[model samples]
Target: MASIELKNVIKRYGKGKTANQVIHGVNAHIADGEFIVIVGPSGCGKSTLLRMVAGLEEITEGDICIGGRVVNQLEPAERDIAMVFQNYALYPHMSVFDNMAYGLKIAKVPVDDIKSRVDKAAKILELGPYLQRKPRELSGGQRQRVAMGRAIVRQPQVFLFDEPLSNLDAKLRAQTRLEIQKLHRELGITSLFVTHDQVEAMTLAQRMIVMNGGVMEQFGTPEEVYTRPATTFVASFIGSPPMNLLKDAPDAKPGVITGIRPEHLDITPSGWALQVEAVEMLGAERLVYGRWAHSATDQLVIIRTEEAHAVPVLGTTIHVTPRADRLHAFDAATGKRMMTA
Candidate 1:
């Protein structure tokens, strides 16, 4: 395991008039044996930053260090890092055992050592039963395990996973997530995972970095990012159905933006009023969508409820109130969060 450090890293394309900067100066220090996930929407430079650390992309400025050694100019193969790509990148012709042993073979490791390493990885990944099968014969989750096993065999200082579970079905994705978590606990290897799925990031990462517009918005543990986001963007982007952002109209708060998570709000008798626009029945939970009832506002707020009884009809008035202590305020212009009562 090795600690990874990014010091004011930047990635740029072209020069002069046509210069396009993808990653602005990003600085982060990942502790040894830590699991960190880089998460953001498409085109937010999460993958670009990962590629730069993997030595697949050039660093236009600053430095990248692994285990206290500068590796800005090193080749991807020479960096001593293993990466599991989004597509699995397995050889179609090779059996699971062969696929896992390929990297060791290329490195000219002893034949006995190769067998032991591959066997151990296969055992850990629960792929021993399918070691003789080719990539085509494996399920998506199994194939993903093979890809991970390939990385495990290398025992590199760093493990890089670029949305490895995105291709799997929902159930498979959930199962694989648990497997990965268990694997991380057992190995305790330093891993950097990149994903667009916030749920994956939240569940898998010990510490997560939220990015937007090619900049690091917030870097913290999953709880901190979810509970007390540093910015409105982080709060809004990290939640399911997203944080309800409403303008604290002149009669309400004085902040540029007021936020209330769907779970933090409730239907109240003496509070704000809303006109129901839509209600979605989602098994155990229902999503109530409506807007504030002070004449008109274009934005809508969502409230989550577990009961289906007495569902509000559309266009009907409903009284809604949020816990004052649970409300979040943010700068209207910059979108940065403000902590207050």
Candidate 2:
């Protein structure tokens, strides 16, 4: 395993006045053996950043170092990294064992050594039974495992995953996620995963980089990013029901917005009066959407509570209180978090 560093990385297309800059200056230091997930919505440059690290894309500026070596001039093959892509680019006619061993064979590795490596990877991925089967005969989940197995046999210093689980169904995705976690524990290779799914980033990352509009919005552990979002975009984007940003919240300053997560609000006899707009039952939890009774605009506030809690009647005004300690403040214009005094 080796540490990877990105120093003020930037990416741009075209030249001169026609240049369309995508990735802004991004700086991050990922520790050795760390599993880092780069997450954001589509077109956020998360994949572009990963491609740069893998040497698949030329860096327009700044430096990318892997294992303390400057790899800007290095080709993808020389970067000592194995990548697993969203599409399982498997050889349909080749059996699983042969597909996994093809790279080693091309490198002129000994037949016995190749067999040993392929066997070890197959065992780890629980694909020993499917080794002789062709890619067309395997299930989607099994195919993905084969792709991962192919990478494992190489035993590279780093592993790059570009939405590797995107093709699976929800159940398969969950199952594959656990398998990936187990795989990481067993082979401890430094990994960088790029995904648009926040659930993947939250569950798999040792640290996560949240990107937006080609900029690195924030980089930190899952808890840090969730509890203390650095900006309003993160606050709204990371959660399921998302945080409520109230422009006309009680005592909120003219240039500021009050942010509150749905779970942080409580039904009370007296507090901010809100008119219940709608209520949704979601398994064990109930989500209550309400509009501020006093605010002129129609922005809605949501409250998440256990199903046992009484659901407020629609169109009826109810009092709800926000936990003082749980409230987040942000500058309205800049959309940046405002630190409490």
Candidate 3:
């Protein structure tokens, strides 16, 4: 396993005046064997950044280093990295064992060594029993495992995943995620996974880079990004139901944006008066959607409550207080986090 580093990485298309920059000055030092996830919405350049690191896209400027060697000009084959793409681009006629061993065979590895590597990868991915099966006979998750095993047999310094789980059903995705986690623990190869799903990022990442419009919005562990987001975009994007950003909060400081998570707001006898707008009964909890009482903006606020608690009546004014310790404040102009004084 080797560490990966991105030093002021930038990517653009076209030349001169018409050059449209997509990745803007991204920089990060990934520790040896660290699992990093690049996460963002669709069209946010996450895939573009990953492709640049894989040597698939030429970077406009800056350097990409794998194992301390700058590889900006290297071909993808020279980068010592393996990639598992969203599509399982397997040769349908070939069996799983042959698919996994194809790369080694191309490199002219000995017949016995090819079998050794394929066997090792297949065992780890639990594809041993189906090693002789063709792609058409296996399930989607099994096919994806074959794709991953193909990468694993290469035994490269780094592994790059481009939304490898996006094609699976919810249950299969969850199962594959566990398998990937186990694979990492067993092999401990440095990995950079790209996905648009935040839950996947939060679950699989040791550290995560949150991107927006090709810019790095935040880079930290899942807890850090979820609890202390560096920017308003992060504040609203990282959480389920997301942290509420209120510009016209009651008793709000002028020009300061107030941020609070739904669970951090509690029903109180007196505080911010909110009129209940809607209620959603989730399996184990209830979500109460309310609007600022008699306000011009009619800002919607969500409060999360336990299933045991009484559901507030729709249209009734309820007072909810944001916990003091949980309140987050940000700058309205720049959308950046405001350090607590």
Would you estimate the TM-scores of all the predictions? 0.97, 0.98, 0.98
Candidate with more favorable, higher TM-score: 1 or 3: 3
Report clash pairs, candidate 3. none
Worst 10 residues of 3 by lDDT: 291-300
Greater lDDT among 1 and 2 belongs to 2
RMSD of each: 1.4, 1.0, 1.1
Q: Model 1, 1-341: lDDT tens per residue?
A: 89999999998999987999999999999999999999999999999999999999999999999999999999999888999998998999999999999989988999999999999998889999999999999999999999999999998999999999999999999999999999999999999999999999999999999999899999999999998999888988998989987786434555568888998778877666788999998888889998876734567889988784579899988877788888878888789987645
Which residue pairs overlap in candidate 2's backbone? none
lDDT of 3 at 289: 96
Relative to the true structure, candidate 1 reaches a TM of: 0.97
Off by over 4 Å in 3: none
TM-score of 2: 0.98
Candidate 2 ranges with C-alpha deviation above 4 Å: none
Question: Which residue pairs collide in model 1, if any?
Answer: none
lDDT of prediction 2: 0.94
lDDT of 3 by residue, 1-341 (tens): 89999999999999899999999999999999999999999988999999999999999999999999999989999999999999999999999999999989999999999999999998899899999899999999999999999999999999999999999999999999999999999999999999999999999999999999999999999999999999999999898889989997767778789899999999999988899989999989999999885565778998999998888999999998899889898999999999632
